[model samples]
Target: MDKHFEISLQNRKLLYSVLKDTPKDVLCSIPSGFKNNIWWNIGHTVTVQQGLLYGLSGLPYTMNMEVANKFKKGTVPEEVPTDEEIEAMKGLLFSTVEKAQTDYKAGKFKEYSPYETSAKVTLNTIEEAIIFNGFHEGIHLGTVLALLKAVHHPKAV
Candidate 1:
């Protein structure tokens, strides 16, 4: 469990660096042939983690639903989020994981509702969900990197 948590933390550290370093314009730009941008990928990862680990466990999510909904699966960016929202999510990228660790230690997650993801993988436990979330985040991180490449090198798309 600690290894899983550590992997997640490390993944987020790399992700946070991307979020912190990317310019607002580049973060928001949906490059040619890309349906979503870097900001969506980053926010979506957090929302998916909350849904997989907390919401599936029948525990309240650490993220605000209003903000979470903006990044939920199948949703695209409707409008640029406020700078404050981006700042809030930047903090949540770590704080939420910290809270999940605390809750796990406290035995807060007792059960999880099984869910089959779009990729056809079903997660049956919080631990499985956490592991799966890492995979999911990695995919989004790749997408973010690809988007960055496309944004910088227009022909890359």
Candidate 2:
């Protein structure tokens, strides 16, 4: 596997552990001023990966349209997914990440949208998408950390 695919697989492992430890109640809770719950973060992190990989790579997405919209960019979990639905979505999230890395290593990307990085560089290759997944995963991971801290800090103290 390439470096990018290797990094992506490692990230998926870390992300899975984080999500596994997150309580359902905490996952559904909304931190102040945020439109999404932890549920959305979990699912969105996975969706964006697939979007960057499969959607752009010319492979079929394992997630259906209904689940995609529930977790896709722009649509918050509150507006589309019930708590139960969000839990179910979590399963799909884990599966897609695993599949995406395999697809990515196979060089199946389709060049759909032009993605720009946080560094302001625009990417037109699957290599860029693989690198970008780490960036995207880190962003969501930070959000999950904050959510856990906010909801569990008082108890911890």
**TM-score of candidate 1 versus the correct structure, residues matched by position:** 0.94
Global local distance difference test of model 1: 0.88
lDDT of 2 by residue, 1-157 (tens): 4676666666666656655666667777887867677777878887887777777766677788666766777777665445577556657656776676666556566565677755676768777777777788878877877776777733221
Q: What does the lDDT read for residue 135 in candidate 1? A: 91
List, residue by residue over 19-98, the lDDT tens digit for candidate 1: 77877888899988999998999999999999999999999899899989999999998888788977998899998888
Error of 1 at 33 (Å): 1.5
Q: Give the C-alpha miss distance for residue 121 in model 1, angstroms.
A: 0.7
Residue pairs with backbone atoms closer than 3 Å in model 2 (clashes): 56-110, 57-109, 57-110
**Which lDDT values do the candidates have, in the order given?**
0.88, 0.69
Lowest lDDT 10-mer window, candidate 2? Answer: 148-157
Off by over 4 Å in 1: 153-157
Off by over 4 Å in 2: 79-87, 110-113, 117-120, 153-157
Candidate that scores best on lDDT: 1
